[model samples]
Target: MHIVLQIGSEITRPTFWLIGPVGKAVFYYLAAVAILVFLAGASERVKRYTKGDADHADRLDDLPSRVVESARTVLSNRTLFDRDFVGGVMHLLVMWGFLTLLIATIILGIDMDLYRPLTGESFFIGDFYLSYSFVADAMGLLFIVGLGIMLYRRYAARNERLWGHHTSLEDDLLVWTLFLLGVGGYLTEAVRIIGQDFPPFETASFVGWAVALIIAAVGVTPELARTLYPITWWAHALLALAFIAAIPMGKPFHMLSSFANVVTRDGDAGKRLPGIPADLDATNAETIDDFSWKELLDQDACTKCGRCSSVCPAKASDRPLDPRNVILDLKTYREERDAGGEDLPIIADGGAAVIDAATMESCMACMACMDSCPVEIEHLSSFTKMNRQLVDQGDVDSNVQNVFQNVMQQGNTFGDQARARADWTAELEFEVDDARETEVEFLWYVGDYPSYDDRNKQVARSLARLFELAGVEYGILYEDEVYDGNDVRRIGEEFLFLEQAGTLVDTFEACEFEKIVCTDPHSFNTFKNEYPEVDFAEFADDPMMAFEIEESWDGAPVYHWTQVVEELVDDGRLGLQGDELAYTVTYHDPCHLGRYNDEYEAPRELVRATGCKLVEMPRNRNDSFCCGGGGGGLWTDFDDEPKPSEERLREALEDTSAGDAIEKFVVACPMCMTMYEDGRKTGGYEDEIQIVDVAELLIEAVEIRDGRQA
Candidate 1:
């Protein structure tokens, strides 16, 4: 048999099987119908998404930036790889290989239909054609390799992430469809090569060449191959079209939605919770239509990889809050609502609610879900919005209600007299300057826990001494400041939070200070991120927003104490004696400071500056476990078994112990100190470990001894 090289012809087999207009017409009809079906399904989803509130339309404004960001997110695949390298590699291979094959198919179509008819010349020829054939063959095999890994993970491997979730039949069907599609494609190529008696140059498609040789050795006649060619060709074409149509019908929709999710994600989502809308009563989302369009879009975007649940402190504590389930449930509610079913409340009366009130309340707003999500879904915001509806309806638990009432009536969660905010000042060696009485360089905003909690009062005093030693001209807001409303807003008490934040911003504007410093990460996050958007005039007439002055508070520069100490140390203003302390210390990253604001290094550097050997917990920095004190978790104990704080303490204890078996568990946030102090006692580690704030540890290293400041 002689081989002929058709160098200037298209790489693909004859379009319409070189048969006639009938075959060409049929292929076009099927392809067009498949495309139309996909668009129809996708359009329905888009309509459902638009049914949500209009706040998310802003995401559509910046086209170029969105495209760049979305492309970067999809191409980098950092979210998956950062957590699990092996799984990330497998996904990257499959994702890129699929894209390459799709591109090849488009090029082939253009070469045959557009270029060949216009110029009577194939665009893919010579070295380019050979390279294309080689790459297509190699990528096909790689695609199969990826599918094999996925199948093994789903069936053979003990993947706990996938085990608990409801694995639908649709998921299995999607995978099998792709697998068979790949096989059919490669087999068709092999059979075509054997039947055509193609040239040696065609062997550049090595996988097809090898398979063709095997088929020839098996005594498959050209006549038999010719008959099989048309069957395999049409089957492969139909399968490809079917895959496209199936994309928007099931879990496969994630391919498109996830990319859009990354592109259109709120830029400052995890950094700041959404502000309560101007019309407080009407803004809370009670049902599918009430949710923001982005929230609705998030439902379609979720891949159900279970990463959020895997890292959730609430889920680990056996609490009702499962981030993954929350997204899935919301998705279900939307689907049902679109199907013309009975209108269902997202947070219903009983435990059987689509998303129960208990589940909404169970979240600690630790932001693990938001951080771990590959598609950048704002899980925390979704839960908070649902909680907002519950709060408006007076459906919150008694403890939560009381906490909200305390903030409204007392300006603090402790329900203490506002005057007592400055009581911690009495313990300092030198009277701390009052920002109300005099202009100061730094206005220290002592948060609720540090001002009222006895254990945290020591931390406040320690920070005061450190400030004095460093000659940092700082003064406290004294009785003038109210709660920062960080956790209050997160807990769904929007009106109460607005009142508190408005009052605080009013005081901040009245006080003459260059910068604001916070003892709590929560307050720091609130002041830095949330307060700037407050419009005080909107609530001026309300009793809770009773401030003498008006005008929206212009944005103020704010710093957490850890940030201040780190800056001071870096600038050589705050000197450490570097006395070698005989203790092993591990630093815990508070949720607000680490994940919410990305200030992990500052606190750790302060710990290292204290002269103690700094040992890291397995999950430190951005991945650090929550201390069960954020998002009103400190105010209302949900009685969750194996408390998150206890779990964290156990992790701290696992670090290699120095003298006295890791003497200190240093923390930066006052809330963290409060949680861990109680955790140390309840976890029975009081004898072995001590919970010390970073400020307190810093003072120990910098404190004056023998009439000289260290």
Candidate 2:
């Protein structure tokens, strides 16, 4: 608003009357050119901030169509939309104003001389275009107000964190400066409007007009207003120029970069994940060890909205990791490097003030934040890579040493043998061992919990019954499978995860399974998405593409128990033998199944097929509250009050439709089973509802029909 009034131009206009059109033309051109030059420099700085090490292949693979679609869904998706609107509304106003202001400046350049002489009639102003001028002025004012609110949010009110505080002095100053730029620019215009009392005042004057009246009422003569206009205008102009120039200097730069980042985002952030290369040349001497500057700087694209922090089970449980800070830290660290500040340790750097080990650990790699982010910042991948650098390439800490030792020597997170991995199968009537030698149609990659946990043993049994009833040629890896280490890798054991994934991949290479499915979503996610990258020297694979391969691999189908059960009903193969076991059950979505993989519907569909009336939880489907077993949370003890699952269970139980209490709460993940069980205990729901796996329910349905058939 201030910039448009051209208060300085009004003061200079009289002087230009003597110099004629040519001199005025030269001055406007120089100012326009100055703005462009500053903008270009800012753009370059943002580019430098996000670039990292060279990716093994193209680091980004999100397709434009998918990115656009996901962005649309982000707005509609309630979970993402809830905590986002305040920030989104403020940000959108500022962003829209930025573009509008740029266009206005370009128009000023044209008005001065680019297209017409400086003496050209001011045809663009006045009541003829009253709506346009009024809108621009209103938007400009709105932008200032938005910036004020944003600054308050970022500084005075902020979330707790691990490394440095969320609000820094520089961040606060940036917001204040941006806000002043808007206010000062508007005031300059108001001064000019009051000085000239121009005929177009009615249209060009909306915001500035009232201020002009106030100045005139104070006995400020037109000549005095004229004198003050140029100084205020120049101050406004200089501040705008400075803000433009400072774009790449700090966190505020995301305002400009977020658009391009969104357009070029990796779509697999929600639908899938990146896959490892299958043909990696382990011996490649030249090409396998580095990440590109762009790849590394990908972290810089973060808006610091803390969406990742909110969904992070680790952070929720008081773990140190915060994805927002991880990106901010890396960006700061990169900036320091560009500034010749690389020699200084990152932790000691000002940027490191926002990042640290706890913030790093708080990330669960659930990708909830990744899916929720409007700009497609890959926080999970960035954090995982940092974990790789610290635990794999750098000196290992004792905590990491302990994890690796347990995984390598013990074969699982709990330091148990593979024998325990199949211990759950012993309770079932069927022998679900490997058919690797017999062209098995399905290879079930059962993870540790389902195998060893007594409660989940029933899930193992239910799935077995469902598969047998469908007459599918599915076989288990039995004792051959090891932990997928998805959680371990996410929790800062990159090398250990690599070792575990490598062992599993090797086993797959030796065996001849047609298709693979795992009861563990983490195992499914890692094997389907991350394992191939165990060796990155050869062909680099995109995880999105890998999903297709995993879907169609070996001409055999891989299905979660839900998918298979759904197929059974679809194919007319389903036979429910049990008496109508009428019970109200509420389903708790596991972060892995619901958020990570977006497999929300299948489990519910399975629940319905059992003829049990489904009692919907308050947070169901994609927005289903997490059970808090993700990111090695099952392994971590919570001495802190209000455990995540206890909170989640309350949400689930609160949604009962009937006066009758919920008798059973079903979940799909072993981790969820563990968590909800603890939640049942903690929430004192142990006497009210039993948390059972969906697989176990299907098993009950099958056994009932089997007896009738007998």
Candidate 3:
């Protein structure tokens, strides 16, 4: 053995040092069996996905883009690091370390078993061997370090997110076994090094060399080391084999399932939503089979990081909704059904149901779960599907029923008559143009709450005045407008949304507009993302209208009014008195605008353009807390205390790193304005913080305050 540099063999270690050919053959057989076991377990889960109702071809159509995006997501660990830095580092280290070690194993296998025999020369010789050993040991150390951190996080520090009902004994054992596997590999290397008298090139294996020194200091002689090398080798190899075999069968399956889920995620998932294509009867989600293959995989992909539940406003507000448990309950039901024909509904009328009705109703459909999820589980889709099932069964509470009826009967959620849709405009001294009759640069889709809710109507009038004062060409649909259906679709009234979308699309067809705009982010989201995908052929009672829509329109560019006002401010068109309306304000990122549409910057810019010191809440942008206004929460009342909006108002008024208690809680969406206003009154924070809209602030600062003045 080469303790120092010898002629040729110093760079590479013996491949089969203590093990004979028979022992090597036995190891190969065990490895092959492990691979087969992994395949059997993984295939079982794959077969379940085949039963899903989703179009497999749709997810697979953009294979290249999916592959690239998935690779980026996995490698960067971007989502993991969003708000939790410590947890992110732990995952990144563990994942990359494991992946690198796996790649090293494959390289060694091909080199020793295939390449050396075929070419009569070692592919992993000299420089390559040294490089491989160095990298492999470093990554092994990283793997061990990461495992240690995770153990500390889970048990010692007791990070609350890591502990939940989803945690099990298997979760604990999985981490320990993986940690031991990495340690065992290092021990095997150290013993081998001692037996070989510690080769000069082997020093490149820094961790193993250090371990070899420690063992030598402990009086383990070379002869004893030689005796223990084979035993240590077999122990490590068997443990590794067991881990491999259990990958898809147990908790580690997240490695494969998560990657697949991320790859198949829709870029516009919660924003666009899945449209019911052929059937107006309604999209059904009675069982796991009703979901898509990607969605089925989504449940399996959950790592139980509790990120979704942790960030969820509904869950934080003491609502029964928990995104992690929702997915876990479905997974349990899926396994039960697959194993022994378990016929229980995923959600049903009583306590016997897999997920409780209260849990289902508590969801705000804010997309926080999906945004916070490292694996892209699409929790909103699951909630929406389950809600659809409830809607189909008429299992929802009375408030939800009334809200749905209001939208169905009166073209809005307030149950106001059709003529009342444009009543807000009566307060404006200037007559707003009917977009249907006038060609305008921007067609404003004045949504339900903005038109009918008094406070929001005041804000809406301010926006109209701003448009007039800026000499911008914009018009509203007036009484012809209906619910934009963003919330209707989220509430699982698919038929209602389709009809509403058809009516709006028909109304849009009559209007000659260059762009679309709205003060309500929900309407903006539907118009920008969902409405474009609405198959009008599956639409309203008018057949001719469908054909016209199909031919004339594919999609439209829709903006939140903040974006328009920000643009105007940038172009010096709003004619603002600089710093005149300055106030310390914190902006509430409407879920539809921030998470669903990625329009965070525009609202903040508008706030800054008013010369206010923009103070941001701890949770802002995609991470912003929801105000409990989404997914029909704005219309349907919840009996729960400390509403999400009220909690958010409290959070907004806290002494942030940037500023102290904010004077104004600025918002861009009408739903947000309404929710926070109500929250302020109920929470007794009305005097502490003012609920104001960006439009209202801009109007006060604008050179002209009203349209009549213009």
Cα lDDT tens digits, model 2, 498-600, are: 5565556656766776777778777766666565444532222433121112221122344566765677766767676324357778888777767676788
How accurate locally is residue 659 in candidate 1, as Cα lDDT from 0 to 100? 34
Q: Global lDDT of each model?
A: 0.81, 0.62, 0.83
**CA RMSD of all predictions:** 2.4, 6.5, 2.9
Model 1 C-alpha lDDT per residue in residues 1-710, reported as the tens digit of each score: 44234644545345454336887788899999999999999998888777788763367778898989789878877788867787787787788878889998998889888998899877577787889899998998888888888889878995667655545787788778888887888888877887777557778989888888888889876667767888888889899999898788988899999998888887678557776656545757677778888888898898778889889988898888888888988887778767887876678547556788777777888898889888999887788888888887788878888887788789999899999988988877799988887899899998888899899899989888878877898888888778888887887887788778777877777778899999999998888888776666777776655675455777779998888888888776666655535468888889998898888788888787767888888888878889988877887767767888888888777743443466788888888888888888888888878888888877776653323632
TM-scores of the models, in the order given: 0.95, 0.79, 0.94
- TM-score, structure 2 vs. true: 0.79
Higher-ranked by lDDT: 2 or 3: 3
For candidate 1, the TM-score is 0.95
- What is the alpha-carbon lDDT of model 2 when measured against the actual structure? 0.62
Quote the lDDT for 252 in model 2. 66
